[model samples]
Target: MTKSKQTEWNFDNTYARLPKSFFSDTNPTPVNSPELAIFNDQLAESLGLNAEALNTEDGAAMFAGNEIPEGASPLAQAYAGHQFGHFTMLGDGRAVLLGEQISPKDERFDIQLKGSGRTPFSRGGDGRAALGPMLREYIISEAMHALGIPTTRSLAVVTTGEPVIRETELPGAILTRVAASHLRVGTFEYAARLGNVEELQVLADYAIKRHYPDIEDNEDRYLSLLEEVIKRQAELIAKWQLVGFIHGVMNTDNVTISGETIDYGPCAFMDTYDPETVFSSIDVQGRYAYGNQPLIGGWNLARFAETLLPLLHENQDHAVELAQEKISDFSNLYQSHWLKGMRAKLGLFNEEKEDEALINDLLSMMKEHRADYTNTFRALTFEKHDDTALFGIPEFTQWHERWHVRLSRQQESKDSVNQLMQNSNPAVIPRNHRVEEALEAAVENGDYSVLGKLLDVLSKPYAHSAEQEEYCAVPKSAAPYQTFCGT
Candidate 1:
């Protein structure tokens, strides 16, 4: 029987009209040889793609940088960013967007391939990615999506059928990344710096139409778009904190206007409940730490607001004041979403005025006791004191008492609340140690079994699985590991 093809990719290139300076018109540097590692059939079908064609030589060739698809306007975008609080000009140095594909839901997603080869923005560096990082992105990004967070999705990963050097020889790879649109806060910042308000407005109008079409009817649509973007980002960062996700590198360029988490470099989930968690090797200062995520997100939005000032109001002073006023809303919006999310995670149904204080107290205790964040919540799902075996440390017993008292106040049935907590709090996260272990097996030993198993476990992170119990455990002290930014 012949496999059915889902060829509904009606291509439309809107961003391509924004002038030459917005991006470099170039195709992905073709790889000499390419091989498919994984293809997201579900995502393919959703994007109205032919899954069978993607498995064929023609589809593989198109995805592997050997050929560009019809109607695909491939290009590397250009922008500037503040990296670790320092300003620098940067662009899609190693990634090329292969046009936008509208899903059956009418959501347009940029189907870009990272490490597709070099472009004008390569900046004297080899425009290639190692297989380990590619697979890491695939696993973690998918895991984030399953966790109900807004994030860029991984559609496919392909091996370059070759090796790339980075600290040693390693197998090279490419990742097909999908996002609402690749436009970032830094994209507007680039045009602002050039004193090109027209270009900035063009980009803003494009974004408004693509993401927030309803806003177009408003007179101050651009300003409203900016505010909406800020609000979305604030909520997104709050979600990251609730889950203990440290982005590691929160550069302006990495802050998407779509508010989806982008660029999975040096990103990690917390094992221990420490606010000042830093996993990215390049993050010398704790700029993108777990606790500081909110502040950093606000800072990034402020940069975006500055970029929009020229288009916000007629007078310069008035625009500045209006922008500042709008930016001030970020903190409150973030806190509101964060507190509500934490309440659900803690299985609190009662709305006390001091609920924020109550939540903070538990976090403080966890920090003092060095409790494993993921396991702490997972154990609570069972609400079994005997299962203190998971906590391992005796000091957690004190915090456990406080948590029980807080739970007692909830009016809901204990069993029902426990079920809600279990669903909200995942038993397993993409732990940094386990992620590195999987990478080592794949890169050093060519063993993908561990990687595949980890992917499967992360797919249903909140589900109770007897066979995958090891994944629910925190890393032993002897096996502690760290993640690095693959810059």
Candidate 2:
């Protein structure tokens, strides 16, 4: 069932053909004894590739960077970022974009190999990734996709049959990541630093063509592009908040122009309904905490606007005024999207003046009682009010009465309300402890059953099946969970 690599690849490398200044020409360094660890056959099929053709040793070699597929021109993109409120140069240090794959449905996607090898931007670190973290990204990204979040997809994870030294020696792996494009806010920042508007204009025109094609011919296209990007970020962050996802690192580099979630490193879903949840071990200051995501999103967009100010208007004063006007809209835009989502999560199809208060009040109660975020929502979705953990409280009893009264105002049937809540609230998430267990079993004993089961349960986050029941059990330990940016 294997086909020639050229025929199945369908690459049209437009990015590689872009101006040479945007990226460094570098192919992935070959690995030793490449072997496939996991292949996403379903994702492959969705991308209009022959799954059987790629589910082979040859495919493993390509994924491992031991064999370059035809039509692939690998390159590392250059960019700069404000990492934790401090400006610095950054780029794809250990990653290389193979090329854009043209799907049967006429959609284009960037097929990049992460952990490929050292690039020009490698700054002083080893250009390699560990097997556990690669697998972790695969699991969490796929889980996020299932939850209806816009995110870069994992095509495969190939073990290099080599070891990488992190804190200790670990098995090496390469992740084949598929994305809309690799353009980030930092990319524009890099372009703006060229000491002239020519490079910046080129980048802006290309970005508008690639992402906001409809706005390409608009008179105020540049400003419109900024607004569109702002709108997408607002909507994207709202989705993240609705699911309780803490990005842990909200640097401008990670804010994609395509508005898709990239870089799964150090990201996790909230277990407890606490807004100040910070999971990254390095985030001692609660800067990128769960509650701070929307604000950070706005800050990142403002940086993007700063890069586009010259293009936004001819006059300096007018451009500053225009940029300020659009950036200010992020607040109302984000609140609209977030409140709408929060309302849906509560099964309130219609808006009311007290909706925000109701939502905030429930969150307050959950925070006070330390209710498991997923479990509390699932309890309400299933109408299990007798569940003592959330329901057996005098304060909550009052909230419950108010909630029911709110529900009575709607004409929607009980079944409809349940359906909305069920769809909005996931029954399971990639719980940190369970994820650790899966990764440990696979990396230590070469047993993938635990990981496979977790993937299966997570693939349908909204489904309340018996398989999900065990996975949904709240964590027994109260110890704070910490995540690492291993990639």
Candidate 3:
């Protein structure tokens, strides 16, 4: 493969340095008539790439699997995960890590391509990605970043000029995914389960240096790293809950050790305030539902702590005890983070002893009236009007009284608080109905303008643009929507 010189990938592959057992050495299978649909020039520049070069044919070739770029050490990572509560061994079934790029800010990010093509880890499945899901990922991941959550950023989306057969024939595409690191809780699980304690230690040390470098000198560094990850996961789920995001899949493998949101399969933001909002078609039991995310996140972290038992202490019994103690802190961490986020959403400048109860009252009213979750917070951005007009429930009047009383006690000006709430709450999300509408337009009519326009609105979610009011509104009753797992 002829590599490009203008793009300096600077592949400092520490994960690749591990035993071959950790990953399968492979290259992306080439695609036909590769075309560039979108490229993130700012992200490329952050990774020290010439934005102009990436827009050229040479860039399209590299991104489309026609050629592997220089300094790229492509491989399929190995790991074990508990999927939907079932423990199993899995790896990078359809994704390849192209290489790592060091940013000008002295941060390292993995440059990977999803749906590039088949590899040993492909597992008898086509390595190609459907255009709808690729675009959905690009949209949601970028929105998560704009919302100030730790998440993988989409670098590019390339068209393969081919069709992939799923439930029906679909346009094929590839996504350039960038992450702080692809290491996950399941990575440590794989090493520990395989009885490679030495390798587990090596992985732990590498993670600490790469992510939690500030705690490297701690005597119990590995355990401290485990604790830090648990705290981050707690805070992350809290943020997701505040924004009404259902991750759809909380598998250990999808949980990034760097604490960034990873996969976007069957994910959806809530329209109505149902505690059990589930969008993933495969989640029949509501295991990964909106209300269950925090519990599932804790479950996933417990599995991670189990993998680090050996490194927590010398004695097996002592290690087990210490690990359990650290894991127990997840609840406190989650509660604190959740309350903080909820407080912000309510535009509460001062935390009172009854703040939790005040927030719960509003949520209960919302749930009873089936009010729109996003719109409720958004409406709160304005003065408390007779929201019963919007909610269409007389009971909401009582809740409004309680909210006004709470607000009157706060010293901050309502305008200032409203301004803060406006920025904190998004006017637009990657709503399932809108995403489906965009996908249908693109697939059925070859129109990407709708998808492009939706992405533009979601990219700056907090900004109020009267031009996008149609996009912000909940879909009409006629536009019924459903989400499906890409499996």
* Model number with the top TM-score: 2
* Candidate 2 Cα deviation (angstroms), residue 356: 0.4
Lowest lDDT 10-residue stretch of candidate 1: 1-10
Query: For model 1, how does the per-residue alpha-carbon lDDT over 48-147 read when each residue is reduced to its tens digit?
Result: 8877778665566667778777677889999989888887888889999878887678778898989988889899878999888898898899999988
lDDT tens digits by residue: candidate 3, 103-170:
77777899888998887867888988988888788888988987888999998888888999999988
TM-score of 2: 0.98
What is the total number of backbone clashes in candidate 3?
A: 0
Candidate 2: minimum summed lDDT over ten consecutive residues — where?
A: 1-10
TM match of model 3 to true structure = 0.96
Show model 2 residue runs off by greater than 4 Å: 1-7
1-487 per-residue lDDT for model 2 (tens digits): 2344533888888887667889999989999988888899998988877788788888898898887778788899999888998888898999999888889899999999999999999998788999999999999999999999999999999999889998899999999999999999999988887756888888888889889999999999989999999999999999999988999999999999999999999999898889999999888999999999999999999999999988988898999999999999999999999999888888999989999999999999999988888888888888787643777799998998999999999999999999999899998999989999999998998888999999999999998888788898877889889999995
The count of backbone overlaps in candidate 1 is 0
User: After TM-score superposition, what is the CA distance of residue 186 in candidate 1 from its true location, in Å?
Assistant: 0.7
Ranking by TM-score: 2, 3, 1
- Order of quality (lDDT): 2, 3, 1
User: Which portions of model 1 miss their true places by more than 4 Å?
Assistant: 1-8, 386-408, 478-480
The candidate, 1 or 3, that scores higher on lDDT is 3
Error (Å) of candidate 3 at residue 68 is 1.2
TM-score of every model versus the real structure: 0.94, 0.98, 0.96
